[model samples]
Target: MIENDCSDLFVQNFSFWKHLTDTEKQFLCDNTAPVHYFKGTNVHNGNSDCIGVLLIKSGQLRTYMLSEDGRDITLYRLFGGDVCILSASCVLDAITFDVFIDAEEDTDVLLINSAAFRQLADQNIYVKCFGYQLTAARFSDVMWAMQQILFMGADKRLAIFLSDEISKSGSNEIKMTHEQIARYMGSAREVVSRMLKYFSEEGIVELYRGGIRIIDKKKLHSLI
Candidate 1:
């Protein structure tokens, strides 16, 4: 029960909130609490007690797991409009997977209680539909990530990831360290660094202090 003033954030994503009925929106506004976390903070630890859904309002979070050998395998990066599943599953089944979430940047989240969610879904058809859609989208993304890990080569996978990030941010320049890239790529940081260096030598990209800037989009696309 962290608390913050959410008056500004409440209307920031009108479309997402507008999907719910007037009453439903009011119910959430009344019950949901706003919480803020600084960068590198843990939102929730793996296998922790189930809570309610966390609706991201701003910033980014990386959900990941640590391997036995002390490596991080990133699952996904959750941003604004994205809902964390731990809260949803806790409300529905009182159980959830062991997943760790860390704030990639300072983040704001709307903490909706399980009881409030259940009540809203029980009364609002649109809310139920929205929930279903979100679940489906999450499943699809997981499937796609799994497919890439199993079937794609490391270089191709890196290229695809970079391409997607560039498209999402609408810029060829991406702000991510080699360690971050390694987590997402499910490879060693040293390996990722070597690959990036190779790409740089090939004039495929330019490495910066805290990021990589794609210089030759056509050639990078050809790699994938």
Candidate 2:
């Protein structure tokens, strides 16, 4: 069940919420469902499941794509207070490819049913505009990821990733395994291991079990 506060917050996240008619609001509330996902859960599997618009209440979600060879690359992530409209691409005419959503950690999400949302979007200009704006922003994120993979070298990418992680967590220590890092980088575990080994050898970082700590921020930035 959606808690009172969470339900309110979910409704409020929609910029058009205030403009909604009483009947429209009631329909939205009726179609929206609260769901919890355990860590590593596949919230949406490619284009196979149209789970609808997800309003994250807590935890993180990783959006990625899989290759035919069984490799996957992280596209972007949604955190608390973020709304994800890509999962409902089935209802939107713009989205063409498959995308996957996974819970990076245990998560709580308020899911607005796709059909209901599509109906709302069709009837309300404000809701449609909001969806378009969100979809554009997410596509920008996807393009950035693609640019990095296509143009940036692994060493530079890893350095930037570590730097960004430190900035986000406000800590030099990053608690993630090589496999996890590789998944984010769209590379193999061995590649990440070798890269980390090189970083350790150069005293740029210290790699311990399940984590890496930046030892030389200057040197790390130099690579980037």
Candidate 3:
């Protein structure tokens, strides 16, 4: 059981929290627990555990899958205040494939027990609808990632990824290694290194010891 008051946290993250009946709210509060994970810790692996819905309280989580060749490809990421329904996929019949969730940074999350949440979802229309809507939205993100891998060129994909990172962090310098970038894009590290070298040669970016800095944002966007 959660030790401190997390009612406010639930209400802020779960849109349906306010609509839940008193009994339903009580059930959730009873079953939910606060958990913390260090960076690089695997929260769930291969759908083996039903960890249930995660309401991120702080830090970030990376939801990824293993390719047939055993490469990790990121499907999506969740940050503070984001609700993660995918970690509870075992309770959702529609999701059949294996998924892995890991902490990208030290993180804290409120975990609602899968059976309890599933029970509520079955009884409450609002809860059910919220689950379905969030699942659909996450699936949309997965599809976009798949499309980028299948249709977009490496240059365009890399450009979009860098631009997105810059926008998300509000910083021109991206603190990631080429191997990390390759994993996110589901590409080979060598390919990403070659592309980055090309970008550096073209005066689009400057590669430093451990990160890349944007030299020309317009040039980067032109490739997208």
Compared with the true structure, all predictions reach lDDT values of 0.76, 0.88, 0.90
How well does each candidate superpose onto the true structure, as a TM-score? 0.77, 0.92, 0.93
Candidate 3 backbone collisions, by pair: none
Model 1 lDDT per residue over 1-224, tens place: 22235434655643356666666666787888888989999877766655567889889988777776778777677898777765465554323456678888899988877788777767766666656666666667767777777788778888888898999889989999999888887777887888899889999999989999999999999999
Top lDDT prediction, candidate number:
3
Q: List all candidate RMSDs to the true structure.
A: 4.3, 2.3, 2.0
lDDT of 2 by residue, 1-224 (tens): 43465448856688888777877777888888889999999999987889899999999999999889889999998999999988898878877887999999999999999999999989988888888889999999999988878898888888988998899889999999999899998877897888889999999999888899999999999998
Worst 10 residues of 3 by lDDT: 1-10
Q: Write the per-residue lDDT of candidate 3 for residues 7-43, one digit (tens) a residue.
A: 7787777778888888888889999998999999999
**How much is 95 displaced in model 2, in angstroms?**
1.4
Residue 43 lDDT in candidate 2? 92
Model 2, residue 88: what's the lDDT?
A: 91
Model 3 Cα shift for residue 167 (angstroms): 1.9
Error of 2 at 42 (Å): 0.4
